[model samples]
Target: MTDRASIIAVLSALAIAAGGAALGTAGQVPQPAGDAPIIIAQATGAQATGPSAANTFNRLMKRPGSEPNIQPSKDGIHDPANPGTALLQWPSEAFAGFPRTNDGNRVDWVKTLAAGLIRPWTELEDPEAEPFLMDLTIVRQVKGSMPNVVYPHLEHTQWLDCTNCHDEIFVPEKGANQISMAGILLGQKCGICHGRVAFPISDCRRCHSQPKTAEELRQLSEKSSWAKQ
Candidate 1:
């Protein structure tokens, strides 16, 4: 095998092993300190580096989209390009199983699954649960054209307990943490989970869930000006 192919094979093996551990332990696999080993592999070409070398080795060992011949089905199963296969087995090819939205972008899996699979609060033990139904909109503009983000606790809570985030990665109070794309890229804030195990940060629209209309932008600007007073 060529060096690149060898590298990819090794990486794939690591990913499968890590995926197994994550599944066995209910997704509690340990994280690497400093830069994640995958970042190092992408940067330094997989040479040994410090104590993280073995951790990185184990971590690296542990750790796309688009187009024709792919179709999204309501049943969540797609006819694989290769016949006789059960399902598309790789994460890179997962988009083939979902429908596109009106704007022609792939549907966000979290939203799609949460809509179909999650039970409504009224069906749960406590219909009126404490910390009652709080959702937040992160309105900071990272760029002039980027959309504002809508974070729904409703979706996240279905899978993760509150202690997963509260007072640890994030404070419960609003505006307490200064979140930035730069910090996230370095594995801080949302980056702690995202880009590591969760959906990658590359899909900008996933978190930037709400695109603003021109009138809405104008109204938001007006509100900001008032808040500055």
Candidate 2:
């Protein structure tokens, strides 16, 4: 009799659970307090204007810009920068394996190698500060392929403003910009400036001396923000 009672109780509990699940699936159960509202609709390919549409719902997720609301009626959102440190990160043999970047320099690879063995991705290129006196493209220190960190002076000056790379972004190169692509891209040379203000070095060929396509040329062009790091 006790075994039969236990079996009956288990069956009753299971029946109750099934009924609750059915109600929940039918969208009849009320959501707990403080949860985001649920959306029930089919997503479309093209644009959709109605509130129930997925596009409109996605717009709700996007936060507007930080600027003050000029017109209360306008519901524009501000876009936030990508996640990753504001500071740039470049390739290191300790991380990428085999060797450091192809551009040979006077960097001390022994300590860098040691650090890499202990912490595979630990070592980064922080080149020594010697007097750089040459006109070369500036490179950032982020990770990417295809001349990742490259910058030319005359062209950048054409599109950017004076304050774009003054005392803030880079120290004046003899009142004229002069740095090497190797150091900058490595984050030790020209990255001293472009890494912060100009577009990140992760986007390669944007400032390379040799660009094969028009789109790439455009990517190197001045963006709206001065600080895109």
Predictions: Cα RMSD each: 15.3, 22.1
What digit string (tens of lDDT, one per residue) describes model 2 on residues 77-189? Answer: 21225343223333232244433432232122334443544332312364332222234555543322243344465444433455656666568654354456577776754
In candidate 1, what are the lDDT values of residues 101-211, reduced to their tens digit?
Answer: 432234454665655533345446786563334455445444444687777777576556778888899987767888988889899988997766666687678788667
Query: Which 10 successive residues of model 2 have the least lDDT summed?
Result: 62-71
- The reply for model 2, stretches above 4 Å from the true place, is 1-148, 174-202, 205-229
- The TM-scores of all predictions, comma-separated, are 0.41, 0.22
Question: Which whole-number lDDT from 0 to 100 does residue 147 have in model 2?
Answer: 39
In candidate 1, stretches whose alpha carbon ends up further than 4 angstroms from where it belongs are: 1-112, 115-145, 212-229
Report the lDDT of model 2 for residue 176: 51
Top lDDT: which candidate number? 1
In candidate 1, which residue pairs get closer than 3 Å at backbone N, Cα or C atoms, i.e. clash?
Answer: 14-61, 14-62
lDDT of 1: 0.58
